[model samples]
Target: MERDVVCLVDGNKHLYDRGAYLWTLRPSIVNRIRRDYPKARNQDFICFEHLLPYQVEMIQSMMRSDEKQIDKLNRKLTRTMEDQEYRVTDVNETLKETQTFGQKIADRVAEIAGSWGFIIFYIIVLVGWIVINGLHVFGITFDPYPFILLNLFLSCIAALQAPVIMMSQNRAAYRDRMSSENDYHINLKTEEELRILHAKMDHLMQHQFDHNLEIQAMIFEILSEIRITQKK
Candidate 1:
């Protein structure tokens, strides 16, 4: 028992239930109708045949907006990756490239001095020196039991070796600091990329849901038209 109304655009009679009132439509659709029919009123009715065009336009607009947002996110991610690329480097290779001849020598000396081979060799030399001097072997009793000359030699070796080892250790600390900074930069960049990806995913999901709802509305409208035709 639905009443009939004239379509605003085509002036054709249609069931009131098969059309939409201007006031109940979305603002975008209302504006589109107003553009075509400048004298259109909030209470005017439009048949589904004319309404379909505006609904399609709205869906296309949403799709375009989603594309623009995705493009913007892609550009942002590219810039972020480019900016972080220069900050990460191999600390070991960089240190090696900048090392001085003296630093190389110091590192070599420290390496040799820290080994068990060096310890054993040093003990053997010391024992040999003591036995040869104390026993006066081969009539070599030049510096008898006190061994002042041997003590001076040991002191000089200690002084030189200490500074060399310290120099190598300082370089090692510098290398560690540079390595830590590089790791931090890499981690920061990864975190930012992940955050941007999450935002992009959320945006896509929200828009996809909106699109699904719009499509579902279109399906319902089509079903209503089919039922109205069958009843006739």
Candidate 2:
């Protein structure tokens, strides 16, 4: 069997199957190689591996002209981004719905305990206890002058209230941590959206640049034709 054969711009020979090549028939590729490699100025073929500086950039520019090309950079970038999955979540709503009965009670207890209304009510109860005992209103005294029984009750109230308040505080800390995490998620999503927007902007700028170059080329061709007509 005979193998395919090819010649490079550098006057080198190789089996066609072993090397990738572009034809000089493409004026853009030929011009790009000529601009970069003076030795390949009039060559009829260019080897992929031996492409000189700016040659790859030229090929990329040509590839961008055709959107249907599978290896197009913009298509690959957008496709990869589209394939990624992200879920938008509301952490606050989720946390609220997942709260346990104990959590609700703890929060309510903490709110009431930390308020001025509860403070005033507590003071009134203490004052009433002392006045009733001092006046002997019921013709009996449960807590005498020193009010030792009242003191015990006060101690018991403090012992029980402290832990309840702490439980509420712990829940608040947990809420703060969750809020922070939610903020992080929001920031991350915003960053990703900005990146996608930036990518789109870059693609648009590249497309506009290519369009302008094509228009310039067309204008040059038109001017050359006009000059030739005028000379005749």
Candidate 3:
């Protein structure tokens, strides 16, 4: 006949098949046992009746830890979403709001100067000037051939138009830079949010798997009890 094992907690004899050695228990369960029985050793035995409370405590502790972790992730995600709401803005509207009067004029001048209407109007003016001066139209001989006054006027307009066009172009470049920076910041935040979400998903999946195993173990224990009661 096999010898009965003595339980460490209750000091009662139990069949070897109905108890587990301390070393065979989960680390968390063993640690809980050691808290009460400071001198507990690996060779000590524990019956399922005494071991059930420690197993329940271990499962509860794991569930609480999972809840805390999930809550932390939720808080972090909420803060990220709140920050995004305030950080995003329309770049065009912001630029327009800050634009100086001179900058508006420059932009307007550049817009008109770049149009086909301006080109056609400019050609008509040039042809009129050349015809009037070269042909001495209506006895207006103030500007003779190679129109010196017209040349001077053209030079002055070129100097002024070039600087105005340059100013408009510089502002356009600044707007583009601001837009690109905004896009970069948005992309970075999106990436951070995605990473956090991914981490949360992985954590939930891992904990879910662990919980499923624990639940399966509890179901089997329940089934075993039901079978024993039926046999009795």
Error of 1 at 111 (Å): 1.1
Steric clash pairs (candidate 2): none
TM-score, ranked from best to worst: 1, 3, 2
- lDDT scores of the candidates, listed in order: 0.87, 0.65, 0.85
Cα error, residue 139 of model 1, in Å, equals 3.2
The true-versus-predicted C-alpha distance at residue 221 of model 2, in Å, is 2.6
- For candidate 2, the lDDT comes to 0.65
True-vs-predicted CA distance for residue 177, candidate 1, Å = 1.2
Better of 1 and 3 by TM-score: 1
- In model 3, the runs with Cα more than 4 Å from the true position are 1-4, 15-18, 83-88, 136-142, 222-231
N/CA/C clash count, model 1: 0
List, residue by residue over 95-206, the lDDT tens digit for candidate 2. 6898999888988988999999999999999998988899898788888888999999999989988998998899788878887876776677667767766766676577
Q: Give TM-scores for every candidate, taking all chains together and pairing residue i with residue i.
A: 0.86, 0.61, 0.83
TM-score for model 1? 0.86
Candidate 2 stretches with Cα past 4 Å from truth are 1-88, 219-232
Pairs in clash, predicted candidate 1: none
